[model samples]
Target: MNTHMEAYYQKRSDIYNHVRNASTYEKIAYSFLMACFTGIAAQIVIPLSWTPVPITLQSFAVMTAGIVLGRKYGVLSMILYCLLGLVIPWYSGMTGGLSVLMGATGGYFLGFIICAYFVGSISDKFPKSRKFIGMTGTLLIANFAAIYIPGLATLYLTMSSQGVSLSLSQLLMMGLVPFIFGDILKVLASSTFSKLVMPKEE
Candidate 1:
């Protein structure tokens, strides 16, 4: 078991090293491709029973991009994702437009840039496979701040603009609480996929 485990990690590490040593253009191209994939992941949506926020594969893709692409490329790709969202109608619920982006949920979409950077940055801190997966999963909670702070704050402001009363507790119940289990599942799945697909570092 130990020998096979060592061989598995060795092969994963070697592939990672080769990818890392590739030309900058190649790396950027790969990251851009991953970014596009993440955008598609965003469109895989499941509306929730209680909240306006749907459960999408976005967080999974966003988080995984960071870990796989590293901070600089991860963030770059997400920014591209955001710009593309403006015209492509690929935002949540198949919505788009700069107007849609600047509206209530823009924060969440914008947050993906920060999310990829922050989560990818921290996940890169670990060296071993076990540490990488565990640390990334643990860091997912902290990374939620990247998503929620802007999302909830803007949501409240948007509600106020329409003379709707959306309290903090209500926001938590609707936006945060319900997504906890699903997000955890995403984190775990992404981390596990990382273990099989790539090395700890980009």
Candidate 2:
């Protein structure tokens, strides 16, 4: 059993090395592609009447980018997505601009960058995380630490700026509670996809 575990870890390490040592052009290409994927995912939105935060596959795409691209390029992809979003109407509801970045969901947008980095770093550091269980666990933590925290804080601040003060429970209802089940599904999907796309040792 120990020998099998060692061999599995070695295989995962080989895959990580391949991704880490990818050519600059390849890295850039993958990052740009992920940025585009995130934009496309953002278009699949389910707007709710009660909350400004819409349900979208953006988080899944972001998590996938991290797992597939590793930390450096994953962060690059998110940065590209966010920066270009300011000039293109690719955000949710076909909206974009600086205003979008300052709106209720702005923190979630920022959280994407942080999420990508956090997930990528973990995947890169822990070769075992390439497996489904590990990847799912990592993404779950990343969702709350890197996404929901910033999202809820931003929601609170944005609402306060508009003279709409809400309690912590209320904030959670708007930004966290409604999305828990969906986010779990997203994490599972992202992990499954990552297991497929992440390199395997030859």
Candidate 3:
């Protein structure tokens, strides 16, 4: 029994390595393609009350990518997308380059990467659970951390720089309040898709 168990473990390891090696290039390519797709999606405007950065569905795409691709690939796709936005001029929108990184909307873009990893990690950890529960919880936690915090910070800084003084209540209304419903919808839609398309456990 001990020998059989050892052999089983070894075989699994070997298979994992073989699969990794075989799919490395394809994974890389897909990650990059997804990133590009993300950038293009971002360019499509969905203007919101918060700022010029409209409430785009690209965040949903990023979240879904993470749940589907797992951690490393999800993060890779996000990084690739950001790098492409920095490098490829045509990939960006009305503004381009690292400038976008500094913009008010940048936090959400950055959040997309973090959100993906968070959602992916949680889903991967808790397989065999109901899809909505896993996806919703992960997404809520991730987006709250990755989007709200940084978004507020960016808004504060931008406001301060612009000398636009506003109370916390006003700030919340302007920065966070407008997008909650849209974000929730995005989370629900993305969670559903991720749960459906994700692979079943062995």
Candidate 4:
């Protein structure tokens, strides 16, 4: 049984290595596909009455891209997503253009890129991060550092510029608190999905 399991893992490892070391064209294609996946996920939005930020599957897609594609290609995927989104109505609420990127939720778009790179870097540098617990921890940290910080900052600045005076507590309530539960769920899901699809290092 042990030998069989080892063989199975070895096969998976080989497949993963093949994809990781794929040709430049193949990597570009994969990055483009991930960008498209993010666009699709952005459409799965649950809007909040108070906050401009919507709950979307974008974080899941971003984290998954990082875990699966590693640091380099993961960043590429997010860059492609952001750039293409400027012209395509693929952002949340099916809205697009520079205005959307300059809006309250714009920081999250930047966060997506940074989050992907941060998660991907950790996943690549620490092989253990491919495991469930490690991946989940990494995702959680990335969410706070790479996602929420910039997200909240941009939200505050944008709202302030529009003459909306909100306290820091209120900003947290709108931009951070409401999304905590859902973000936790997304972290778990992203970790699980990543572990299932990513092979254990031989």
lDDT values, one for every candidate = 0.75, 0.88, 0.70, 0.91
Q: Identify the superior model by lDDT, candidate 1 or candidate 3.
A: 1
2 versus 4: better TM-score goes to: 4
Question: Compared to the true structure, candidate 4 yields what TM-score?
Answer: 0.95
User: What ranking emerges by TM-score with the best candidate at the front?
Assistant: 4, 2, 1, 3
lDDT of 4: 0.91
Clash total of candidate 2: 0
Model 3 bad stretches (over 4 Å):
1-22, 89-94
What is the C-alpha lDDT profile of model 3 across 1-202, one tens digit per residue? 9999677656654653443355879878868777876777677656764565565667777886777566788789998877777767523354568877777666766777787787667766666432677778778777778777877778777777888886898777766787789888888887777555543342
Best candidate, TM-score? 4
For residues 123-143, write the lDDT of model 2, one tens digit per residue. 877866877888999999999
Q: Estimate each model's TM-score.
A: 0.86, 0.88, 0.80, 0.95
Model 1 Cα lDDT, one tens digit per residue, 110-183: 77888888866665665453354574554475457888777777777876787978887988886677778888
Worst 10 residues of 3 by lDDT: 12-21
TM value for model 1:
0.86
Two-way lDDT contest, 1 vs 4, winner: 4
Please state the error at residue 134 of candidate 2 in Å. Answer: 0.8
Q: What does each candidate score in C-alpha RMSD?
A: 2.5, 3.9, 6.8, 1.3
lDDT of 2 at 151: 90
Stronger candidate by lDDT (2 vs 4): 4
